[model samples]
Target: MTGKKKHSEGEIETVAPAAMGTAEWQAEFLTQRRLDKARISARFAGKTLDNFSARDKGRKMLVHSAQTYVSGFNLNKEAGGFPVYPKGLLMTGPVGCGKSHLATAILRGVIEKGYSGLYYNSPDLLRDIRATFQPDSDLTEDDLLEEVTTVDLLVFDDVGAENATGFVLDRFYLIINERYEGCKPIIVTTNLNLEELENRLGKRILSRMLEMCEIFGPFPEEDWRRRNLR
Candidate 1:
């Protein structure tokens, strides 16, 4: 029997008779869930570790580390066989340095391993939380917080881009602290340097993040976008 499946990009795929009721079928279902819950954007929909450019030594190392992290990921615990709290990756780099691409690729890998994952652009997440206050909105703040905190993996992209108001700070603290307390894994990407991130997110959140994640890079400042333009 043949079946049609609609992919995240709205493309249709023919599921062969051999794939039906098999591991591939299950994986397809999980992929649908990943596309919906992860909320990866169209621009990044095509990004995968295989396609990420790693021509330079620094970028090659970054890609290798990402691949290792994904391969070693465990749904019940941290990556790399750590029996302690679930550790994650903190990818710090300049804008256009491919941090988000790598972050999304990691999230995709984790989800494909039968674990649930979510990807949220930090500012967009805060904006959604704020929208919950509107009378017409369908979701509550707790609902959103619970979704992020309970996911098997969470990719929080552009960590310091949101405005640092008290409200924003409190919400961010709650999300990070809950995940930290739960020993859940989180992948964070940001352009901010250590000092700048500390200033933006405050010591409390930064401390928790430092404890929860392994630092990846202060990647070279060469902008891929600029290179593409040249």
Candidate 2:
């Protein structure tokens, strides 16, 4: 067979690596998935980093911090390797500091990564779920809770936006605690600092949240929203 022009019929196969795949492929796949999710994300008033103006400094910090938390991630990375992820984020700073913006921007990444995510403001969540308790209401509290407690990523905006009552606190705990047990990731945005957060959410919820998240502070030189308001 030497020096002979021999050709055998065989299929040229392409396989994506389960691990250490080509960076281009992985990045491309992730980008596509995000674009798909972004469509849905946009429908809900969620916008990516690009939508907001001049978040250069905060955007870099947020992305890097998210990557750090997400990389080397294990459901059991915490004590007993709780099936739920220990890594969560508390983005705190002044108003218009882009805390909520950053949370959604990360979701932009999640979408590209082809993952499930849920976004809700703390006040709206309480109102919506509580409204179901009205006797004439069609949806049951259990039904609403089930949907909420099961998302892959649950985002809470305006965390201390409302003055929470005991009922809301318990309800909030139930949802977040279940996520904790299930290893789901949660992202919270707040205008409040740690001390103020404790006063608002209370010690128990605070303890649980701290157990789950690493705090990321975005220090803006000015109130971003105020500046943006033309």
Candidate 3:
């Protein structure tokens, strides 16, 4: 289903705060910026993680999923805000249902709580990587690899939105496969159901994803966007 464009994808934009000293204040300041990363992660989770969506006189509430709890990811949290684990979240639901928001909310919240994070849609991220192929582009494979491996958190919205071309699938596999070896964490939101996910993610990635992260609730009240639009 088409989303109602209720959530602001732009909210995740964060200016990297700077620090250039060993002073306690400077160290703390840098830590705060690092936390900004996690804040973005948490926000991503809150907005996209399934919440019930309902319209009431053209207004929206953007509810949260009752079946979910953030603390359960404690092992994940204790390891490091986005632990860069082999497995990460794989949110499933209809389009415009806040799957992306959940990812965004979590990213944002975690950053706010003092952690690092990175966010991007799957296709856009791939596009950026492809652009680096140009001779004038400064980004190297190492740069692409770092985003997946070094970031505090890596968020992939619309995981399979790109056409499932062999090249695209291969690229997707490479990132996930490498991260699996490194034990990095990731967050993925998709407008696909269980069957569709099985089809799109394939058996391998699906197994890794499930092994790494818990499935957020996809209940009737889980669409936060619908609430906002109302």
- Lowest-lDDT window of 10 residues in candidate 2? 1-10
Q: How much lDDT does candidate 3 score?
A: 0.62
lDDT of 3 by residue, 1-230 (tens): 12233347655443333333447656577666665544244444345323423454222322333223233333243345444223467777777655666567566544544456788787877787789899998889668767666675677788878887777777777877776666667787788776787698688877776775667645343355465566
TM-score of each: 0.88, 0.70, 0.65
Model 2 per-residue lDDT tens digits across residues 46-102: 566556555467656665665555444444444564344547788888876677777
- Of 1 and 2, the candidate ahead on TM-score is 1
Superposed by TM-score, candidate 1 places the C-alpha of residue 44 at a distance from the truth, in angstroms, of: 0.8
Task: Give residue 124's error in model 3 in angstroms.
Answer: 0.3
TM-score computed on alpha carbons, candidate 3:
0.65
Weakest 10 consecutive residues of candidate 1 by summed lDDT: 77-86
Candidate 1 ranges beyond 4 A from true positions: 1-18, 77-83
Say which candidate scores most in lDDT: 1
lDDT of 1 by residue, 17-99 (tens): 77677877877887877777788898888899999978888889988888899988875554577665558989899898889
Clashing residue pairs in candidate 1 (N, C-alpha, C atoms within 3 angstroms): none
Q: Is candidate 2 or candidate 3 better by lDDT?
A: 2
